[model samples]
Target: MGIKAALSKPFAAYVHQRNQAWMQQPAQTQQKVFTSLIQKGASTAFGRDHKFKNIQNHADFTQAVPVRDYEGLKPYFERVKKGERDILWPGKPIYFAKTSGTTSGTKYIPISADSISNHINGARDALLAYVYQTGNSTFLDGKLIFLSGSPELDEVSGIKTGRLSGIANHHVPGYLRRNQLPSYQINCLDDWEEKLDAIIGETLHQPMTLISGIPPWVQMYFDRITAKTGKKIKDVFPDFNLFVYGGVNFEPYRAKLFESIGKPIDSIELFPASEGFFAYQNEQDDPGLLLLLNAGIFYEFIPVSEYYNENPRRLRIEEVEVGVNYALVISNNAGLWAYSIGDTVKFTSTRPYKVVVSGRIKHFISAFGEHVIGEEVEKAMHQTMQKFPEVEVVEFTVAPYVSPSAGQSYHEWLVAFAQPPQDLPAFRLELDQQLRQLNVYYDDLITGNILSPLKLTPLPSDAFQKYMKTQGKLGGQNKVPRLSNDRAIADALVKFKVES
Candidate 1:
């Protein structure tokens, strides 16, 4: 047996050991994790102020801490940044993940030493879970290239700061580091185009077997590699069979990415955010990602329909039912207490806790009370694209366009299509119809003449890419918000068209 193949046996065993079904005892397990977090962080100011002293169980903890977003937690985080020790987590955090802010340039999210293990190592554990369940680990023998951001570090709040992917890339164990491509020096260059070129130059001839990255950048890499070699990706790397993706939904990019691949390959969908590696595709048969219950993250759910209520129903694992869209709330070892990360998900399985991300709380347009979200928009795009097989949407975003002229408001959709639709009006009509069916509020708005029919504006090629670059979010793990409240991106799309 080959060295890597021989190692798979034990690795598979370890994955099996870690992922045993504790579904029946989910509440019991979640309560245990919650108790541990409260006790560990009690001495910290956040915990003490929230009266963590009197908290003993779920009800107590819920009443004590309350759910919070990044803004709600910002003041405390700023204190941590100013070299405060044991302020949020015990002692100071080892690093801070720089994530896009709603109101600022960036939000330096604390990354505890334990968070490194919880999400970073949990990512590996998730892969292992796939390997164990599928009994396929031969790819470990060859190269496993990850299109990652630079591990380039900065100091914020006296904490080391960079993208979460960069932080995790730095923590890749010595053993696997040998098989990873693109030297640390090359990745640190900061220019994505330059970094990708360096990666291609270094890895073009390697026996690559597994490729992992966000869908858009990964598609870019595949195209570049194919063009440079004048060969299909499968031909260039015959052993390459696994394509692991996260950060954005793969549905929109699936056809393009698969066309680049030139053959069928095993793929795994993961739900890894800056907050945690919450879930991943474990069984091939199951479409939903299996929630990582034991991975040092305690979870709660609140229905989106009741999000604005004075007191919404906060549900534990035992309380969730299949097919309900719920905003995920998490308490983690990263010193986060009942934090809401703005993402919404729907339960597909309640027993072992499997879910598909539904949308973002902030990334929705509810103007005119239509209540449209990313999932609905994407699904609409999917159905519309089906009618025109030649059309391929590269990237798109929707926003409300309110004019100074009364009764002229409508939702404006800015789309950069790789292959334009045969008839633009037909495409727009199909999308409008699909969205109306998906959202009753949207349907009512259309029927009641509260909003005009959706406006479709075609953008020049690479418009989204250029825009993201200007935002300093050009590459890894960053995605364009599918829906926006204002016309900033739509206006920019107009400027791009004029410039082009």
Candidate 2:
């Protein structure tokens, strides 16, 4: 191992040991975070509005501050954007992470000085945890590339504002700066294709050991690398050992990624967003990400079944049960109080508080009361593909097809295939069967004749990519939603469909 890897071993061990202290007592750690958040919030304008002084405990907190999405908190956010002090947070945010909102046009999530460490530390420890567990810090010796958004920032009331990834670019640790690849100028390029080509040109001959990005974007980089070098990614970057990814589930893209690399590699999955860095995969063999309880964030979970209820019971860390889908609520030092980030997660392990991102709360199919989530669809796709080894999926999305020329209403799956299955009908049957097994509501609808079995639409290659390009969301944390309740996306996909 090189000097950097050699030095990281001892520090990695120390960090791992420190992390275990809080991971073992998750509820206690969370309670401490809750107390700290409440104390800090008491000094903000939101605290006065919500009667934070009267709040004593978690139950009191629920009563004082209702769970809200971005729109619900926009009034205070607007004040902060207008340079108001102590509006939502204790003071004006250091930066506003501008994100695309579904209902609200655009969201500006605040990143306070106190909460920035949580974002930076979570990412750092994820790597250190891997180094501690596997004694594999060799990647530190070579180029570590993060395929992220532009580092450029515009000012909003004198505070810097940009994409969360772009804001994070300014915080890359000093030690790793030497190993970080793709010149800053290339990262600042607005067009993804241009930035990608620039990234390839810069790193094509470098000793790239770690490449981090959303899986699809990374796949594009891999594709470009292979096209340029006329060799597998493994041959071009012989030392590349770690593939760090977030934003989407890696299973669907796993096969294609490994195929391009010509071998399997270890990966670290992160559960990060504009709001905060929530979790990171610690163990190489574990699929569950270790939730960061001691971070400056207090977490709550409302069961998905009860999320829409007038008074949904918000469960604290100790109350969460394994395998139950819960809408993740957070109150952090960043001043987002009892805020619903819209993501749902399943607790896989409670001992160390490990969770897997189940789906987005809004990104579900409940058109006919048969609610299906992202996790269920991804699993069904994964299982069906396992049986049909030749089938290679590029991307896919499901939307309700309520009206059909013939027969009952059915869910329509639009799939872009890298290698289309030989027997499309058989493949569709298996895929439908797997989904039915995973989701009982879907199964019941099919059996009750209320809905027909799902129909598969084999889309032209690059259909999803083309759609994303058209929407100006081609890369950098932009992903196609796995489930849609309406036909908007499906109707748009029709033009890209392959005719039988």
Candidate 3:
């Protein structure tokens, strides 16, 4: 009935119809998208190096370009940072997303003109798809809150450089900017704690209908609001209905979030990264987001099973099969050619090429050759919470303890709890047992006495948050690593250990 809803209805219909067609011939859509990108950037340095002119087919393209990671692409990025035009894209990138993970200390990822469109339009389509499907369009009539990074962009050789949140913040259209909560002045406060305080002060009494943020920061906001007003989140924002979150798995945080809301609401899972907006959940019931075939990003999959092989197979969209774990690779309009984005995924629907995030290639516990992954660890936690409904995980990270400390080397878990299990030892045992079920290599490691049983360490009350804060990674897309290759992060958490 609202003006925004009335207008968006047709737009949503258009998107749904187009998506249906795209799904019918996923390979053809992908071919057209990628061919266009190749032609567009043929004169650029990367394209020339890879002989894109001769790449008439996927086979030729594969032979021409070797896969690369951030470090492998660093040389080109260095030239880009110096304002070189046609070094990657035809012209200079409009901005760069500055980020760091446990693996890469710092990365300045380019965002081309086409890449900006992909991100902004992809986000709009994802939201509209949900609105159209659920027949609930009133959320846009009221205020929308996005817990995001500082919008203050610093110039790098005349190109904007900042967090991806800041990059996104800069692109909100004027009309939507009017409905967005927390004035621009407050949204660009720079410091996470300071920005949260400003956000609380500005919008606590406003009529907010939608909120989007990573789960950890959103949890922090919910807790603070509950403490401040003595009301559940649903009561505080009576019209709140839509919650959009990504960046980390939402399973562990689901129970706690709903408990804070005091009601069920529709949620959307997104699969985006510093490189590109890869996929979005179009259906309410379907857990997998459609691997967008026409998003100006070419898709490739390296089976994690063969990722370490001397001659690992790189499978394209048509070549991928359902139920296989793959390290996702993308060559996008952003000029990142044959780049490995690091996150792993599994195909849930091959017809439309839909996928669910499986884990990360670098994020695992393989210190004892067990090779336990994020998916396994997450499932273990999910089961742990299931068996003991009284306990809820606030945040947790696991690292392989390969040291002979006290003559026992095992998996070390650093956990902070909102409400802990009644029997902590039983909870630890169940988690370890679940991992044994999830992975045979891990079970073999235990059976062969190569590694001891998992170790459980109860972190101080707010240790995860405190540790993240200390690392300057407390909000807006920064996440604590769930699994570390070494005790570097675990040792840091030990310092914040709650002496039980």
Candidate 4:
């Protein structure tokens, strides 16, 4: 083995040891750690400036500080935008990670040195868990490919400000950073076209082991790579062992990814956001386990049912019950206090604090997993529609449909079109292909003949927008509900008979 490979194994072992210790800690100890961190973070950021001299528990924290979304943080960001120092955190932040919200134009999320350190450490912990689970530390030896967001710093007000993805690339450990493929396949940095060319040029004969990125973007890269090289991905990265992806669901794209790379389900899904790296798939086979980062932030769980209720009970990490779905609330050092992340999850076990992502409380379809959510479904649709140029979707909604005859259930899609495809039947075929490629569950469901075929209905031009308007939820802060569990919403959509 080479020097770097030899060094990485021992480092991997060290990480595994640290991860084990943290995971083995009792729930009470974890809560204590979380509590101590929150008090420290609150004192450090808002203690002197804001009036929070009376707050105590997690409930007190949430009540003292109203739940703020990305837009709520804008005033603090304005100071940073003006090049002021120590606007949110104690020190001048090194850079900003630009991300988008459903309504907010673009969020320039600050990344302090401490925040960066937290992310790197969390990533290391995740990597070590992978090593322990897989029994393959050599997976770290090969060149790692990140199907990352555009790395180009956007030119704002004649000043170059790094986008979130680019800033993340910059902050990666220097050792691993050196082994990264050239800026080409890196996706969307400033010079996108040139970067694509560089990625194509460099990975011509390299031994890549790990591939990481959002699912849709990764598939896009694979398509581009296939077109350029005239070889399937398997031929290019024969030794690739692990695929680490975040910012979306891997279920939809699982089949396509594995088929393209000719690998098993050796993939890891990370639950990270522009705000912080929340959780990661500790075991490749398991969906993902929430490893509460007690050091960086304090976490709270509000029962999913309480989202609409005014008096929702907030549970600390220690108080959360297994098998129950809850919305995650976080208070991180970045100055977001008791912020609702909008995603929902359920605890599978409380000992090691393992959890499964139930769904986004704000984003859900039917009870079945068929209700695709943000990153996963978008990637699937993009992949499926790539074959058809004439078809363009302005908006879409998915709902559960149970066949009247056989009582078989499946997901039915309602798409509002910008333009209709010439061949509707062919479009359906393409959509099926895309869904199969995006998620193995759907593929397996189809192959097993357990679920009925996905049904697609085309809607009128202004149907989605009009519906949102009728609900008094048009434009800013309101998004077209992508997935809905409520049968009432589906019934309303069909009852209107609003075109396709």
Candidate 5:
């Protein structure tokens, strides 16, 4: 191993020891975080308005602060944006992680001094966990690339404001600064395609070892690299071995990604967001992400089934059960109180609290009461792809087709394929069957003639790319939703659809 890799051993060992302390007593760690958050928040303006002083326990907190989304939290956020201090957190946030919200057009999430470590250390620990477990820190010796939003910041209330990834760019440890690639100037490019091309130019022949980004965008980078050199990524960067990704499930893009790489490589998954860095995969073989309970954030969960109720029951960390889908709610040092970030997750293990992001709370298909979720469809797609190796998918999405041109209504699946199946009809039928096995509601609808067998709408190779470009979400942290209840995205894909 190189000097850097050898030096990481001691640091990795230290991180493992520190992590073990909290992992062994997750509930106690969370209680401490909860108590600290309440104590600090009690001094903020929002705390005063919400009666935070009386919040002696989780039950009291629930009563004091009802769960809210971006819209509900905007009142205080607006004040913070206008240079207000102690509005949300203890004082003016060091930065505002600006993000595009579905209902609220633009959002500015606070990043206070106490909370910044959560984002920075969470990512750092994910890497250290890999080093500690496998004892292979060779990747640290070479160049690393993190496909991210522009690092360029716009000032708001005298505070730096930008995308979460952009904000994170500023916090990269000094040791990694020389090892990171695609130069700051290239990263600051406003357009994604432009930035991607620039990244390829800069890292094309570098000794790259680690690549991190959302899966789809990383696939795009891989595709561009291969297309440019007429060689798989392995040939271009022989040492490239580790992939770190978050935002979307990697299963859907796994086949394509590995195909581009020309071989399987190790990867670490992270659960990060504008609000906080929540979890990361601690073991190479484990699919679950170890939730961070001591990250200056108090977590809560409302069963997805009860998320829309008049008063959904918010359960503490200890109250959550394995395998149950829950809308993740959090109160963090960033000044968010009982905030729902819209993502849903299922616990794989409760002993140390590991979870898998199941889907988005609002991104589901239930037009005909089927309630098909992202996990179900993703599983169906993954199984069908495994069964039909010849069918290489680029991207796909599902939507309820309530009004078809003819016959009974059915579910519509828009798929952009890298390699189309030889037997299109068979592929469609097998995919439908897989979905039926996963979701009884969808199966019942088809059985009772409430809907027809799902239809497959082939899309051009560049369909999703074109769609994302049109929506101004072409790259960076933005991603296409896997499924939606309404036809917004489905209808948008119509123009790019092709005859199968």
Candidate 6:
């Protein structure tokens, strides 16, 4: 075996051992770690003499604290915006991470020392697992390229941070950080054009082994790389071994990406958000296993079936059954007790706790009462795209648009295809039919005459990227809003008239 291959085996074994050790810990041990943090947070947020002792010990902790969306946290975030410390937590947080909220525009999320530790440790564990699964430690040791957001911190006052991705990039171990990359590649600290230019320049001739980021930004990076170098990504980074992506569904964009890079699907799906790095796909072969961050937070799963019921049933991590969909609720050190992050997931197994993201609870279009979710749209699109063997979908979004008349709505699909379909109408019908059959709610909406017929728009070749640019959201953490229910969605659709 080559020297690289020889090094890989033991590295893989070490990673597997560490994962097994984590998995073998008793439930009580994990719970205590979470409980201790909650106690500390409670004392810090409320007074030390507060009535609530711990998250699990207090019913008021659950009942009094209403499930909050980002908007609800605006007041606390405003404190960060004013450069105030100890607003969300007791001490001065290490930094703030600016993340985009659905309706509240942008938010400055606090990232404490402890939260940064969680992110680093989570990333380490994920990397260890990747080494074990791929049996390739060379990639781990080689230049790791992160197509992250700008590292620019705010020039004016307030908590002064750039994007969340940039903040996290700053926290990565300095020893492991690459040198050839642009000094300003840090998203939380630089201007957009300079940052993009730096990223392109640094990556031009580098032997990148790992690439990580959201799909859209990565796509933009590769597109620019190709434009600048007059070469495809594979030619530029032939040594690239792993593609790590998170923050949005990557299924639609995967085909085009692989084609562009001429690489196999050795990609890792990282389930991270501003809240925390929730989970990562352990083995590339299996569906992602929820490597519960028991050290950071207490977890509870509410059955997906209970979402609409009078009283929803929630289960502790130990109580969750295999093969059932559940919404996640977390009690974390950040002073969030029994907090529902509004994402849905389904357990594939119990022993190791493997799960698939079912959908986002709030990111669906149910305006006319159809209740279409991210997962449903993903499945329908996947199935429909499978029928057209030659075509590849690069980006797609669905919005519920109302007709000029009041109380009339329909599903409008905006799709950007890498290769145009030979039979566009048939493709649209197939997709619509798949959705209608997948969810009875959709059928009920249509049959009850509450919604107009499904509409499809084939966007211009550069539609999505242009849209992103127009919004000042061209890179890093911004994802194409997969589903939108806002009135502005209809207005945005006007920019791209129905394909001729």
Off by over 4 Å in 1: 404-407, 498-500
Candidate 6: lDDT of 152?
Answer: 60
lDDT of candidate 6 at residue 27, scale 0 to 100: 64
Against the true structure, candidate 2 reaches a TM-score of 0.98
Model 4 error, position 56 (Å): 3.5
lDDT of 1 at 424: 82
Task: State the local distance difference test value for candidate 6.
Answer: 0.70
Candidate 3 lDDT tens digits, 408-440 = 789999888888889999999999999999999
Question: What's each prediction's TM-score?
Answer: 0.96, 0.98, 0.98, 0.72, 0.98, 0.88
lDDT of 5 by residue, 1-500 (tens): 88889999999999999989999998899899999989898999999998888989999998888999999999999999999899999989999999987779989999999999999999999999999999889999999999999999999979999999999999999999999987999999989999999999999989999999998889899999888899999999999999999999889889888999998899999999999999999999999999999899899999999999999999999999999999999999999999999999999998789999999998899988889999999999999988899888889999888865443899899999988898989999999999999999989888988889999999987899999999999999998889887889999998998864
Error of 1 at 288 (Å): 0.7
Error in Å for residue 166 of model 6: 1.2
In angstroms, the error of model 5 at 66 is 0.5
Q: Give the Å shift of residue 145 in candidate 4.
A: 1.0
lDDT by residue (tens digit), candidate 2, 1-500: 78899999999999998988998888889888888888888878999999888889998998889999999999999999999999887878999999998689889999999989988888999999999999999999999999998999999999999999988889998989878877888989999898999999999889999999998889889988898889999999999999999989899999998999999889999999989999999998899999999999899999999999999999999999999999999988888989999999999998888999989999999888989999999999999999999988888999998864444899999999989999999999999999999999999988888889999999976788789999998888888899998888898988899888
lDDT of 6 at 160: 49
Model 2 off-target regions past 4 Å? 404-407
Error of 5 at 437 (Å): 1.2
Model 3 lDDT at residue 334 = 89
**lDDT for residue 168 in candidate 3, whole number 0-100:** 89
The better-scoring model by TM-score among 2 and 6 is 2
Residue 310 in candidate 5 has what lDDT? 94
Model 1 quality (TM-score) = 0.96
- Model 4 C-alpha RMSD vs. true structure (Å) is 9.3
